[model samples]
Target: MSFLLNEIAPDDPMWNKRGALYAPSGEGPTVWAADDIYTVKAASAQTKGNIGFIEATVPAGGGPVPHAHTDEYETFYVL
Candidate 1:
């Protein structure tokens, strides 16, 4: 397995910034095909034994659909 840390700029265009906060995709979900409404602030991902992290934000009432990972276990902690 491998581990690494990654950073994303809050001002990144991927997350449209409006005033002081970032707005959800104005182009709609088709742009990213994300089922939920959120802005990626950070994440810990694993692919083929490679691990990495990212940062993001999730707007209120936005979250992932109810699903399970068949190949791995997943968990969430409310902050």
Candidate 2:
């Protein structure tokens, strides 16, 4: 099932300590845009499956850093 933006609550505990428009991951509190998309796992969040999304924007001439998934495959669609 699809969800609306307003329906999702911000994971406040995950917010950055600097009070910036970014959140830091555990291992490395790397700066992530406030709008960056994140997913909730089905088992953990009680959904059908793991959810995935993006909430950040690419600066002009900038793109996502190189990365890969070993177990799961992802499909992208542009609306």
Candidate 3:
């Protein structure tokens, strides 16, 4: 298995600005496309463009077509 590690310097100011982010279950902006659902749990604006949190629920054989995000990266976790 491969692992990615991220480390921040001890003096980094980012550490001082860290805070909790909570989104109670079933609470967020939801969008529906056909039979699929996309929820914006935490938007980019809320995270200062650092991240765009999304939770998606798609029916069998439903999802985005093969694509690439040129500007930034995207990661997905299957539930």
Candidate 4:
């Protein structure tokens, strides 16, 4: 089965001190930019050290290179 555009979403209750939306900053360690690419999303801080996540808009044929991870597992959910 498939889902519509509005059917998929991820909300973090820990977004703010009072359930507010989390804002991405322009100048922070979470912000990365290069080669016409820009992304500011949560990876670990939002998961309380349990998981890492990010809602990124990856360009065509544009993604991160392969790397190794011995202590963590990765999952990709392309909604």
Model number with the top TM-score: 3
What's the true lDDT of residue 66 in model 3? 78
TM-score of each: 0.33, 0.32, 0.72, 0.47
Please state the error at residue 15 of candidate 4 in Å: 1.6
Model 2 whole-model lDDT (C-alpha atoms): 0.37
lDDT of each residue in 1-79, candidate 1, tens digit only? 1223344454556543453334344331221224433323323321223432222245686655567778765455557
Q: Is candidate 1 or candidate 3 better by lDDT?
A: 3
RMSD of 1: 10.5
Model 3 / residue 57 / CA error / Å:
0.4
Local distance difference test, per candidate?
0.39, 0.37, 0.63, 0.46
Q: What ordering of candidates by TM-score runs from best to worst? A: 3, 4, 1, 2
Better of 1 and 4 by TM-score: 4
Worst 10 residues of 3 by lDDT: 1-10
User: Tens digits of per-residue lDDT for model 2 on 1-79?
Assistant: 2334333223444332344323233221223443343332222122223544343334555544567877776566543
Worst 10 residues of 4 by lDDT: 1-10
- The number of the candidate with the highest lDDT is 3
- Candidate 2, superposed: residue stretches over 4 Å from native: 1-46
Measured by TM-score, how close is model 3 to the native structure?
Answer: 0.72
